[model samples]
Target: MARASATPRSSAYLSALSQEIEKKLQRALASPPQRRNLLQELFADVALEVDDRARDIILSREEDTISPADDSHLGQLCFYDVLADYYVQAPESGKPILDLIVQLWSQSFASHIFSLLFHKWLFEVQLDNPEVLLRYSSALAQGATNVFWIDIQTNTRRFQSLFCYLLDEVAVEPARLNKIPVQAQRDLYLLLSRFILFYNSGDKLDTFLKHCPTFPNAFLIGGPTDFFVTELADQLQKLKVEPVLLHYLSNLKVLQGMELRMATSTRLKTCLYSFTSPGGPMYPTRAVRHAAWDALDLLFPLFDWRSRTLHPVYSAHLQRRSTA
Candidate 1:
């Protein structure tokens, strides 16, 4: 995970940026009354998209050459993206910032900063102490969960790269996944399960399901597929954003042939059915209802077919309503 060394000029620019961040954190620590605001501002600074001018300076090299597409695959570069790489290259330089973060751990946006900056370090650095490793791992999971929820609520993909790294590099990669404690590993998988589709990562669903950790309640939940469906169903119930809900319903087709327990299947069916009607529980919009019906048709085709055969009147009723 080591990054290429930056040139002296770019390195200096990043060092100054780091100093600014450290200063803000230090100020936050000194002023109890303003700690929350300082920390929130710091989070915003790191999360802000890197502008064209800043991007050029941070990425400059001694050779006077930088690939225009260096960060293309990563979507857009953010301040944290450069800082995270800087910390990886110079871990010692980040110690002061890390110390400040630990002191303000309980404050808002603290974990978000930690996750964004140290996610790679957490995996790449060797922690001989199990207790420390677990603590850091827990913070990472919590921070990631918070930020992912931000994306869900706003219906944006701002945190998609973060999700992709955790899913692609850590969750499915056994060597890295095992870097954390078993409990943290399980928690991370479950967190990813809930937000997988929100981040447009449904393509990784099969690999993700294969790598799911064994849950303590597997006897009740069945297995990976069942646990995943259960989480997705619960997630579907909680979503209020029309676009995100439609995205979930559209992606639920991936579960069509997966072998789920009867209870799990029923739970998913009930969750989706709640969205198919314009009623109190779900209050799905017209678009969501149509998407839900399409999902139900894909997941449980025979249910509709059987209902049509046994109760033609009900089938016609649903058909008319759905078209309307």
Candidate 2:
């Protein structure tokens, strides 16, 4: 009877302990040493249970139902609240702590780490707020772009699958894009566009782009030689986002080189030169041309395609290769 009573008492004690720790975490996360050190203390005190409880708190919602705001709070609090400022104030001391959290949490609870970082990136920088986006894009554009790349680099398959899962969740049925808010739709569009534009140089980025759903391989590979550009062109036609589509394709052409095989289509070839064939060329407006050239110039130095021809540099090279 005494032992039975002790068991309930122990249960109650642990429950109280958990509540105390949670309350402390909420408060502690708001400040400095507490912001960083409290996490360490929690790890020491609660050990692996920290992962379980934190994961449960974070993953409480169905993945599809979770919003950027939901996933962003902790990361925003940690970075924008005081910790990042602390890092700025004392890089030598604070950098290690911030780095440790990013490293250890990533290793231990990758999904949670990814959720925090990805949504933080979206909510902080990738939102439809023009002022915020422009400021962030100017201040730390590379860092903003690196957020997605770093997550993918951390664990290729996991992050890729996670991204696809998130995409599926946001892609509501029937109404499709109309299901997401107009702002959210624009933000999502920017996210995709930035992925194409910013990370256009690396091999992993190339492989990622080639395989991503927007350029799915099954539809791309094993088709006719002339069909490569057409496949993407047709897909873009269906989506009807002509400006974004043309600009993205131009970035891919510059980055991927002959890999895109845009010259394979004779009609596409002519349109590439004229840049004014409204009836046939997808890039009908000057705005679309400028956007494409902007992406190209950003990635490639002195990339004045007007003074020179892309066909001489890229298309001619592509023509020599055997289609088989």
Candidate 3:
């Protein structure tokens, strides 16, 4: 008699189950709202099954010892694709489904799932569609923040990579930075600033600051506020990433009538002075001081002092005096 086939019957069974699930999802999307409930139940069932397998695999081996090739043993790779596709198809419903699986799986397992979902969302989708990109990015930012904040130490690299990726994207297409909704922008930028202060170091930190844009709107709401600007200044000074700070400060513009504009200007001015103060490290460094001076000189003209009685000529005179 012929020997048993080399294929694992277990793998075959899982593959068939995945296909059936996909068919059920397609049907669910097409069917009435009541029928969709069955699809939701099926989704929960799949999450439970995958969660069990992932836990067993995680417990059987050490974290770093497990290789990508080992994902097959846990049926993780297949499920990763399936869940991501489900989310892409039905984002509203699929978000909760994805959340359930993440809560049910081990950290490593959840990370792998998130990685796949993020990859699909970032690389596969066309960024030209601003609305679609915003929705997806908001979802991704929220999901990653929720999952990783619990164990930030373990997820440091992921957060760092995300920060760098968004920075690069904005660096390339500066307009995209402001187009994102203020709330989403705050969420992403807050995460990035946290990464910069805690997770990043040396060359990576410098590079991030250097590429940081000068867009006025980028700094208005969700971008760097007064607190972050002050905090980032201290971090950069400690890291001796002063030149990068120069690039950052060079772009600082206090537009007229913006909310908190006066407070922002005051904070920025304090930060600039700190760079060139008597005991500051950059006080003796000509390049850093000059860069800081140039930035300050540029910013001095934009201060809306909001004086009701001061003449325009006096304001102009003061502006000219400061530059002189």
Candidate 4:
């Protein structure tokens, strides 16, 4: 029964997969005219199925998977490539077209979106691979660090082995990011922005804080709190990234009358006012503990921890939510 046919893993996988396919299809459009035309024709049917709402989902989901060469995007050239219409056509507004598309798609497709998305991405990855997808054995694993934000209630520790594997194995290469084409960079930024919203992912708060200023792909990067801060997290630092963490979290905290303290070398002995809500918006109380954790990230990642210390003045802010 359609009513009973919903599961988190299946849905998340599909959403992730759809994004990969969209990315590959866009990349493929840059090839020779003959191939380009062929690809466009192939997707013409898919394009036809996409109305305004479908357009939004396909465009936003398209960029999450950026290939080394974008061979997958060859799915472009279709009379109605979602990417073609949004990025190629839409002008820069206060909000980008990509964001607009995904927001629109979420209204009706919420239930089936992720599962449908995962299938699209899997097929796209296997399109070039004659073999079954050996790559995605770890794709879900790649997303492991991000699971915390997916549903905080889910036990994240269960996936530790997979996270270790990613650390030991596959991840974003610092070198290749530069070699990426401009279109890809643009596409990814939009994709990241939208997916963060779709996932209701707070993990990106760290990503926003780290890369929002230059968040190349709003949807692509995750905030610091996300345990997924592996190579990609550090690799992004190589470029100028925009940190949007405070902005989003501040908004959330405002509702709960909470205060946020970014990690710094300073201590918070002089600080006051605790964000009482345990899981409403803010996190566990231990300011001294969280501040120390942030300082470690800021000062010496490899150095020892100092239990007794109060240094520079810690910077922090507070907010309350809208009564309306």
Best by lDDT: 1
Q: What are the per-residue Cα lDDT tens digits for candidate 2 across 1-324?
A: 000111233334434543554454555445654555655454334322224443343234442343222323223212121212222223343323333344433232222332423332333222466654443332222333344555333322222322332343332221343433444443443344344332233233333333232323435442322333443333334323554445444655443344334344433433333332233445446555454344433434333567764534344433322220
**Shift in Å, residue 227, candidate 3:** 6.9
Model 1, span 1-324: residue lDDT tens: 335467777778878988998999999999999999999899888988889898778767666555323632346777776777778778887889988899988999999999988887888777889998888898999999888888889988777767877998899999999989999998898899899987778888999989988789899889999888888889999999888888888888778689989899889878877887787887889999889878877887734454455233235446655463
TM-score, structure 4 vs. true: 0.24
For model 1 the local lDDT of residue 24 reads 99
> Whole-model lDDT, candidate 4?
0.29
After superposing candidate 1 on the true structure, give the runs of residues whose Cα lies further than 4 Å from its correct spot. Answer: 1-4, 62-74, 302-324
lDDT of 4 by residue, 173-278 (tens): 2232223333433333333432232234444344342432234333433332221222222222221112222222232321121132332111121111122223
lDDT of 3 by residue, 1-324 (tens): 011121233334434554665455455445555444644455345433245564344224333333222323223333443344334433553444344434434323333334434434444333567675565556656555543343243332333333444545542344555555555555555545533434333234434444444445554533334434545545445434444444444444422222344655576566665554345454525565556656655655434458545433234344443433
Shift of residue 30 alpha carbon in model 2, Å: 4.2
The root-mean-square deviation over C-alpha atoms between each candidate and the true structure, in angstroms, is 2.9, 17.7, 14.9, 17.6
Total clashing residue pairs per candidate? 0, 0, 0, 45
- TM-score to true structure, per model: 0.91, 0.28, 0.35, 0.24
lDDT of 3 at 240: 47
lDDT of 3: 0.44
Reference-based lDDT, each prediction: 0.82, 0.36, 0.44, 0.29
Among the numbered candidates, top TM-score falls to 1
Worst 10 residues of 3 by lDDT: 1-10
Candidate 2 C-alpha error for residue 67, in Å: 23
